[model samples]
Target: MANPNQEIKFTKLFIKNEFVDAVSKKTFPVSNPANEKLVANVAEGDKADVDLAVVAARNAFCRGSVWRNTDPTARGTLLNKLAALVERDSDIIANLIVLENGKTFANAKVEISRFAQILKFYAGFVDKYYGKTIPVDGPIFTYTRKEAIGVVGAILPWNFPVIMLAYKLAPAIAAGCTIIVKAAEQTPLSALYIAALSKEVGFPDGVINVINGFGPTVGHAIVSHLDIRKVAFTGSTDVGRLIMKTAADSNIKKVSLELGGKSPLVIFEDVDIDEAAMVAHNAIFMNHGQVCFAASRHYVHEKIYDEFVKRSAALASMRKVGDPFDADTDQGPQIDEESMKKILHFVDLGKEQGAKLETGGKRIGTEGYFMEPTVFSNVTDDMSIATHEIFGPVQCIIKFKTVDEVIESANRTNYGLMAGVMTKNIDTALTFANAVEAGTVWVNCYSAGAVAAPFGGYKESGIGRELGEEGLSLYLETKTVAIKLPYKN
Candidate 1:
């Protein structure tokens, strides 16, 4: 095993904007997926720590001037300052993400850049916030006010910790809401690093708190905390459901979940076959297919099904996998051994269920949590790989004849997070985009969008949205005030 003490660095938790020892005094190993070794120690917090953090956030929300009737321009300026700070430290954050999350350095940098842009976008929204005017009868006057929601609890995922954190945090803070963010245990380094800078950027001590610990303990504690007025979570459908149940039973805090996805990529016969094939390749391969909206399920037209599979398998095998720090690295290890094992289990289940594995189906080496870029052909809609969110570099191709058939196959799963359509025909693009049961549909690209676009899931995938104006609204509550206007003589 890699030296746990040498690789991991953090030894404390960031609570109330200060690095402090956990009440439990327990430490967990931060593993580097690059070589499957112990990197450093991070604080192991539990319910007591959660309570303290929640109390701090609640008090801050109720008492701090930073988030209470503060100047919108000032809020925007602070966010911009933080964005600049992030840009200046982008390399540091990128390196931490690569070390702790096991994505290629290039991808990590891009993710960091995206995160920065998201913060900037939310900051831009602060000054443009507006309410509504209502016409009143007689001398009565009424108007609605959009106010910030208090004490937001953001539960983030490990796959893209920094980027996902931006997805939830940027808009909430921009809208003048205090937050207690729970970082994923698998990849908490970048978040802690950012927590440090958040203080440096002049956010009040308790305005932003980060707790690094296990999901069931620290995470559950944050969710169940009575003082938290809202919960924003990004993870699997199972966990999102659990959060919903917990929130309902507790404070019924407003919740927004961006959960799991078994996304589909539909290719129409009218589209250029080769172009569709290449797009499909990128759709499933980018970020090693760990994205929430990875086009894992490919619904190719029956006329070109065989060619697509052969080409996709060839493309999957051509990917480069090596050190995450290397600029040339095309793919890196999964977050950890457990995650690799889960992906492997899914692949094995696919084989057991008679889905033909076309190419690349095994662990790559003894070092790290690397798995071969896998592509499975002849997949039935009901196959585990086609239906479940594998969250790895695995692609399952299914055949379809018509638009209706493709739509049906795409919507078969409980997850409806996103879908992609590659078609030259205008009718096909419009039909797929309109009919697909997903929160976001990419016409020709997969996982392509600006921070201005609202991202979320449909059906059991999740609730609420993130990014753009919708995300901004999640952190706000609307109220109306009425008064009697002076009568004109």
Candidate 2:
């Protein structure tokens, strides 16, 4: 039933399972970054729209509502139904993602495929989520109950739209919480389409809502609203800080953020140079280097530095950079012109600060926002590229002498999202993995995460985890209930 050739269009705000226009009757153009052409004119939601969405979510989360009082197994069943619908429309969703986000068609399909798996993963937790019984003294029985944390406000990023939506929405819904999602203005089509699919799947009214607009107006309203009990955001660290501040200043709402990363990949001299080169190339160049946990910082042992750089450069040159919808394309344009300009600025800074440009440091074509897959050698910690979170296709390779030295150098930056170590010796691999300051460390691998495993950051990268059992806990609150029984003879 999934039709890859079906034409899809969404041009309104989806609130309370209904498509409606904005209160001000204003609209903004959604452009296809692949060709820099107009896709649709979307309703521009503001604070007024956010207010209505929050109210709907609050009502749905109330004590006697259909959503809040539903049986746990029934809730799981509904989630499974939603997953089935996602599977049925995966092709359409993937094509819409390609049209708006500019990721290669294969990558878009991969993201869409994960939607069902993620939803089912969380759905399994619906009845399994339990609290422990405690032994108390005398005539009292004590235990704790895990309850849903009222209304959630989810703010998604432009990159990986449908996957991120599954990460936030699936867990929240499984935990019996209503949500008001604010899709990134740059890529709102796929999320709106998925919302429509949810309505077809028969979710209760006011259970799932979505709106599109600028961050300052729509996003700010979601974080600052007093009725919103929890706020989950995935974006830049600067904006994450603003959300935290807004939450604290308003009503002290619970917050979870998955922010930026400047993760490092360490390669030892013992491994096969060919395999290391391939992994290193895929780590940074897989998603046009736009991934949060991308191994942008490469720390190679001095013995294999030259050979690794050579192989990586050769692969970069062979990459197919063109339109996203093309099946053969390996790389596509950046999200927009602003992102292209920012990435180019960092490329210039890397050169000015004395790093050697190895290959692919300029724009690819005259149209769209495509940039060359860039690599820089002789990069030191002091360089601008090495110090900042360059969310683009720019790799910085630094040479190191020992595990201790590389560990210190890799932990020098403020980010601690993810780090990778590739080696054959168990002691060496475990040593580096233990020494690094990151939330998740990969040994002999990179950027391969699962829905069953918890993923998040350490320091500035984020506040809480997003997947696995821990992810479900983020949407739930525990309350201790003690009942006093009549004294027995």
Candidate 3:
């Protein structure tokens, strides 16, 4: 473990452009996953704190309020200012992420950069988003009014805290909606820091509120708050379901969920075995396999199965797992002990269910929550490791015989967030691309998504899109307007 002694600021709840203690006056300790050491004790918010945030957000979203009456182009300009601030402080944000989320320092920087890009992308759409004019029958003139959907409750995830926050906040701002951000329990400090940045960039008071707390209290409050017009979430499917129920039970607010994924990556017999194997390795191993669209299940054609597994195991074994700040370290620790133990349980399940472990399945030194990049071969579709969403650095490689067979195998799982098909054959690539049930499909790549592309999931994976032009629509409402003109004047 490397030294992570950076000074922490803004550990209190950010509401109405001010930082304050939680209503309950409780605090939770945030620790460095890399070293298993306490970083800061953040203000632990409860339902009361959430209520305060909701009040602030609703006030900001009120008709004739500064936020509600702000021009679309002005909103875009404000977003640009925030994006510039984020870019300028990318290193500091990346440092916080590395200390909290255990993301590799380099990758954390990349994630921060992507967050800026996403902000700018949504910024570009602010003034451009519009409703269409519809042709009407007889003497009627019909059109639609595109308007903001009022206050939004954004419940973020821990894996990529800032990046996922970008997915929700950027679009909400673009649509001229105020937001109450519930930072994930594990990684709250960065969100608070960003909230400060948002205020510093001249956003109106109460336009953006962020709080830190557990999912049961603060998250529930945000989801069930009646005044909030929409809720955007990025987390597990189980919690997403609860949010849906809570929203329905409260005010029937609009919701968009980007949920869990056990995505599949297919390797055809035609591609170069080594290069393809590395791509598969990086797909699963990146971010310690904590990505929602991580290629956890790799399907290799039988012809190249042996070589692929050999190369994959070798690569997994060689992956350097250590301090995230170290330039050479390839992987970091799990977020916490509970997450680490859960991952170990899945590894045990892999071994017990007759799947052969080729490389790693054990924890590293006991100081931190570090684990080896474990690879499993001879995995079947029915195994627990293959069926469950093990958000860790565990890769399960299964053998397949044909295109139809692989496609069926891929679709067998309940998740359909993203899928990858690597092949030189255009026909095979196109077929797999068309057949896959995922929201996003990459023909020759894995996890290479752009800000302009719509991203979400299918089935249990999730309910709505989170990026591209579709993202802005999630925070907006369309009101139909029909005027009957004097008959032919």
Candidate 4:
């Protein structure tokens, strides 16, 4: 029988479809962010370990039969199989995610389901990938062929570990590229579970490897590895810039970054106050407000500002905070104490700047990294929380008079990953959607995304898209092969 309190130890790393001890033999404890308790022990891989994984992935891409020569239909079939496997083990994955990442169990299950959905979506597109032949003037025939970029390196964040994992992995596999993933140190169990499932689904040895360790060590190593042909990263803008620099210095590998955001939610006066207020509540509180696209900044029309603030504050105070495993828990603790401190620091800065805290600007209880769902009114665009990616359950509300001012405030941030507009007017909705400098604009909705549509950041939020045909392109390289026509013009 396993020890109840002791975390299960994963002494080996996943490489070549099997578990092997890390070459460096370093190890680290995986802790539950909710209570700061150990949940598991994962190999702490570094440069040498990353090199080994990269070589394994490169061989899998270049010499192995797993993906390089697989037919598109066959590739799709494998991805479909993987999706089914994920669905079957959704509960297990969700439990692990909650245990380590501190997200509510309900939200974790939804994330798992979303992961499966993305896998299925990529599977659908695998068979649909086609090379186009363009009709050109004269005897010249122009054609394009898409081929896999080998040995993709995927660096995931801890916030939505498994879901983000699916976002990067599914499309890469569908495009016939072997991948090596570095899971966030804060969460590693789900990645291990995913590795186990990959073997069960018959992905060949070395095709998909998962490494767990610190970013500077494992992440940098993977990004700088010569064998890595591409890098797909989801993290902070600072880290994204570092990865870009590393990739540039070592190799001209393709880089895809989905970075941070201080997304805005615009609530026009024409919208239903009740409906808009409720929508805005979910916008800032979902996932404990740890979402990259969480509507952290709110721009409300002055006409309904008082009512909106009142309703939004009431909803924030009503959120149930407890262990992530509890079904009744609406929100869990921040990822860890460090993150909790960072969030509180931002909240303090909000106070220092003279922003009025309507409610919830302090930690909730002493048991965990539990922060009260905070809301700040009278916030200026210049406030740090108003401009930075707080990545917490803090909502900053700002009032605006005109549509043009609202648009300007919404677009003022350096990050433009997503923005929300709560307006019943179709004309206003369309106008905001068109004018907002964001990759995704939600009308009376927040964080609404599907695999059919492409997702990315417009400015510093990110480089490269993550879903649909555009996402798949990140994993593929275009090859134009031509031969002289039988009869020249």
Candidate 5:
């Protein structure tokens, strides 16, 4: 494996604006998935560390605290400063992401750049979040004002650590809420680096604290903490459900979850077969198919299904699977051994169930956690491979006859995170886009989204939205103020 241009190392928890060792004195080794080499031994945070971080966040959000008392415009200025810092150190952050998360170096840079953009996007909203005035006939004057929702707990996922951190932190900080971030143990380096940069940007102590640890300890503590008024999580649906239950049982905290997806990509007969195949390939193969919104299920019109599958399989076969740091590598290893095994298991089950394995389905090499970009054709909706989320680089292609039929098949799963429709017919595009039960539907495109666009799920995929104006609302609450004039004039 090619080493990053710069050496990046972080081995401590960031709490109250300072790097500190965990109270438990325990640490876990973070490995580079591309080469299966130890990256660093990071401080392992548990309930005790979470308690301390939560207390600090609670104090920072309390009345008269510097973070709580800062004006919205000033808050925006701080966020912008942090954004600038991030831009200055973009290369290092990107390198850390590649080293820890095993995404391609180029993709890591894109994520870092987008991280800064998201910060700037939320920074713009700091001074723009407004309240409303209700018109009344009586002498009483009433108005509603938006207020920060105190302390927030953000549990990030390993797939896109820095980007997810930006998604949760930018909005919460923009809304004047203090946050305690729990970085996934598998990829905590970039997050801790971000916390270090936050300290340099002069954000008040405890306004942003990052803990590095596993889910059951640090993650559970953050969700159940009474002082954490709001919780934003991005991970599996099973974990999201657990967070919801914990929040309800503990303090009824406001919760937002961006969870798993068995999203579909529908291709109508009108589109160019080659172009549709390429789009479908990237939708599932990007990020080694570890994306929450990856298009796992593909439905093509019966008229063009054969051509689409042929082109898609050819493209998947040509993809360069190797070390993430390799300049020409099109795909990297899965996050770890567990994920690799799980995906291969699904591939095996698909074959046993009579699904045709079209292109690739085996481990690539003896070392690391790499797998061939697998594709299965003639997949039925009820097949486990078609139904479950095989989060690795595997695609399932099924044939459909009509738009209505595809829509029914697409929405068959409980997930509603995202979907894509490819067609030249405007009516067909609109029909599929309108009928699909997903949160975001792309027409003639796949996985296209922006910071200004609201993104989330509709059904078991998730509970609340993230990104855009709706995301800002997740970190805030509303209170009405009333004034009554003495008697009638």
Candidate 6:
């Protein structure tokens, strides 16, 4: 049913189970980040478009509406159908992801496949996620029911469009909430394609909608809408704060954010240098260092610091940075020119602040937005690259003498999204795992994302979790029902 060969077809706003243009009929150009070629001219939605989407969502969410009255088990069935549709069209979806987001074909495929699994994972929870009953005092029968939080405004980030969409869309609908998605301005096609599949899967009108536009207009309207009962967002920490304030100001809407990170990865002396090198290398370098939980900060034990640095530098030199469509390519360009410039500015700041530029420090070529895989040695926690979220392929390696010192160094930044530790000693791994401020810590296994795992952050990193059973909670509200037993006189 899905044609991977078909050219980019769905480029307009999706609302109420139909593809429609924005109210103003304005369009924005989407370019391939890898080559700067035009991908599509997507419709640009603003406050007026967002208002239309909200109206459709609210109508579908009203009492006795088709979506509102759908049985929980039926809802799960619909989600499974959506998952099947996604898997069947994974090729087309992955192509869109690669073209728009500038991730390698392998990475894009993996995200699409995993996204399908995540939808299935949440599908299994549709009927199982229910509230509890408490034994309160007196003759009162107190039982609680987990109800949907009504229409949800889900805003996505460009870095991980498919995954971020899954993080919000799957669980929100599973919890019976009608959703209005504000797709990332740069990567809106994949989301729009999937929403079309939802229609084929038999989801009622207004249950799923996606709009494309810049954050200042579409994003701002979603978070500040009075009728939208909840807001789920994945983006920068600064933007997350604004979403919170705007949602509170409008109607005190429920909000959940999966924000930015300066995640750290540490390599201990006890492990094999080769294995530690790969673990630390891929953690940051994967996805062109665009991962929110990328191991941007590298802490190596003092004894093996030089070896780790050497191995890491060699790996960086070998990384293939070019077109995302290249079968053998290992990295791709930044999402856009603005992102590329920001990463370059940080690269400059790293050099100016005295961090040793071990390998790369400049853009790859004049075309596109590609940057060489970069590494810095003799880096301190105070360096700009080490402290900030560059969202690019720049890894900072810091030498540490002891566990306590490394733990302190890892926590020095304002972010705590994810951290990695490479060591054979369980005590060392457990110590670092326990003491580190990250929400998720991988011990010798640095994969922070899984369908079964709860993904989120600590402190300024974010406010709530986005996967597992916990993710569904953000879209639900518990209601307690108790009625006095009819008195028998």
Best by lDDT: 3
Candidate 5: what lDDT?
A: 0.91
Model 3, 68-131: lDDT tens digits are 8888899999999998999888878888999889988899888888899999999899888888
Cα lDDT, all candidates: 0.85, 0.90, 0.92, 0.87, 0.91, 0.90
* Residue-level lDDT tens digits of model 1 in 305-366: 99888989888888888887866778988887777898999999999999999998899889
Better of 3 and 4 by lDDT: 3
Please give the ranking of all candidate structures by TM-score, highest first, separated by commas. 3, 5, 2, 6, 4, 1
lDDT of 2 by residue, 1-489 (tens): 223344756779888889999999899988888788887789999999999998888888888898888888777887888888887877788888887888988898889889889999988999888888898888888899999998999999998898899999999999999999999998889999989988998888899999999899999999999999999999999999999999999999999999999999999999999999889999998888889999999999999999888888888888889978877889998999999999999999999999999998998777788989998999998899998888899988999999889999999988899999999999999998888989999999887899999999989999999999999999999999998989843
Identify the superior model by TM-score, candidate 3 or candidate 4.
Answer: 3
Report backbone clashes per prediction. Answer: 3, 0, 0, 1, 0, 0
For model 5, how does the per-residue alpha-carbon lDDT over 1-489 read when each residue is reduced to its tens digit?
245645755689999998999999999999988789888899999999999998889889888888888988888888899989988988788888888888998898889888999999999999888889998778888899999999999999999998999999999999999999998999999999889899889999999999999899999999988888999999999999999999999999999999999999999888989889999999999999999899999998899888888999999999999978889999988999999999999999999998899999999888888999989999999999989988999999999997778889999999999999998899998998899999999999988899999999989899888999999999999999989978765
* Residue 341 CA displacement from its true place in model 2, Å: 0.7
* Backbone collision tally, model 5: 0
Off by over 4 Å in 1: 1-10, 63-69, 486-489
Total clashes for model 6: 0
The stretch of ten residues in a row with the least summed lDDT in candidate 5 is 1-10
lDDT of 2 at 382: 86
Which run of 10 residues does model 4 get worst, by summed lDDT? 1-10
Backbone clash pairs for candidate 4 read 16-206
RMSD of each: 2.5, 1.5, 1.3, 2.1, 1.3, 1.8
Candidate 3 RMSD to the correct structure: 1.3
Q: The CA-based lDDT of model 2 is what? A: 0.90
Lowest summed lDDT across 10 adjacent residues in model 3 is found at 1-10
Per residue, candidate 4 scores C-alpha lDDT tens digits across 1-489 of 111242443446898888877777778887777777777777888888888888788877785355677788887888888889988977777778887888987888889889888988898888777688987776777899888888899999999998899989999999999999998998888888888888898887788999888998999899898888899999999999999999999987889999999898999988898888888888889989898989899899999999999988998888888877777889998988888999999999999998999999989777668899999999999989898888999989999998888898899889999988988789989998999999999988887787888999989999999988899999989888666676867
